[model samples]
Target: MNKTTWAMVTFSVGLGLSACGEEAGGPTVEQVAKAYEMYMNVNLATELGQRIEVRGWEDFKPGCKSSGPERVKCITGGKVELMGFQGGEQTVPKPVSVPAEFDLEFEKRENTWVPVRAQKK
Candidate 1:
């Protein structure tokens, strides 16, 4: 092969190898967990005067090994607190606490992680 062609081939191979070694561009396991916790807390507080307090997370997987880049799933645990009404005509309800689990799925689109599904388990 010509010197110019050989140089181009070498450069292409190097670039491909570098790209392969790089990590995927998307939210990490911790970031995804934090976002999910925040979403649950905000929605619950808005709708039910309650919020979920995340104590910790476990069984977190950043990417789906079997399904490849298209799907990722994470699981977490927390406690949900049912807040009492403050300064409302209705009587204040007693606060209730419950243990909760979350199952979350995320998809990769154009190098970004998009939440595809979320469930309370």
Candidate 2:
């Protein structure tokens, strides 16, 4: 193979290895919050045929002073606009803004974090 082709192949292999190594960390606080928001939205839609418009989060921080590597806890305040179904057959739309507080616990499973428990504060 030509020198240019060899260099490209070597770079590609190194890039792939780096990408694999990058996957070995747990999710950040923001990622956990996002996931929680998504979970809430999916659950609401499935159970009540409603949807939430996530405004944002506040006071997001680690729940414990020194949480171990395996388990993590986080607390945050979230704002969401809840859209409810109204009228006949729940076909109408009514949206209301709601603020919520959350305490979430996660466990590091392999390379990802999974929420083990969640509660509203």
Candidate 3:
């Protein structure tokens, strides 16, 4: 084969390998976004003085650097249960530690949403 052809082949192979290695079966950025969304939702509810609870959870991204386990809990006498997904971002970007679980409730006086509690599992 020509030198150019062999070089092209080698480059292509290297690129493919790099892509696979970067992913490394870790949690995706999307997974982290989802967890943030859920956490926000629960926190909104808790601010309104509503009850909250959590049970077991599953990690969306098993090996993701920013992905961790999520727990599902029953709340308000099973009226409102929540599953919280954790983002593994440490003290680099975000000012607060990544939450392991989130409990949200509502406030009757202000009719607003708030976070009742956040815990690190």
Candidate 4:
């Protein structure tokens, strides 16, 4: 087989094996909170065209439950600065500290839980 085909087969086999060996149980509260923060930052990056970090997880809560065999649902919230640049050259989106709250759902793929939904609350 060519090098490209060999690499593809290897990757496919690895992915299949990983799925078969996926972790069980819901993620920890800390992990759920961090995942929420990451998703929020990703959203802000698109709208603000810059990174605005989510912070203050000291009072964080994951109120998570098993929504499915490999899924979890959480009611969580946090804060982030809504400050971005001033135009298409980073146009002003206003700079202000804001509450970031959401009802999020995650699915376990392999060993990590990935956010599958983020409904604003």
Best by lDDT: 4
Model 2 TM-score (2 dp): 0.48
The candidate scoring highest on TM-score is 4
**Candidate 4 vs. true structure, TM-score:** 0.56
| RMSD to native, candidate 2 | 14.4
Candidate 1 Cα errors over 4 Å, as ranges: 1-27, 49-69, 77-100
- Candidate 1 residue pairs in backbone clash: none
Residue-by-residue lDDT tens digits, candidate 1, 12-74: 112221211124443454555454555565445436654444334344333322235565564
Each model's RMSD to truth, in Å?
16.3, 14.4, 21.3, 10.7
Residue-wise C-alpha lDDT for candidate 2, range 1-121, written one tens digit per residue:
2212211111111222111112244445455545455556544444555544444334334333214767656554545444444332434344455654556555666545555665667
lDDT of 4 by residue, 1-121 (tens): 2212221111111222222112335555555545555565555454555544333444554566778887778776554344444333433445465665767677767656666777778
Ranking, lDDT, top scorer first: 4, 2, 1, 3
Residue-wise C-alpha lDDT for candidate 3, range 32-92, written one tens digit per residue: 2233344544445345444222322232222222122222211211112233333422213
Cα-lDDT of candidate 4: 0.52
Q: How good is model 1 by TM-score?
A: 0.43
What TM-scores do the predictions have? 0.43, 0.48, 0.23, 0.56
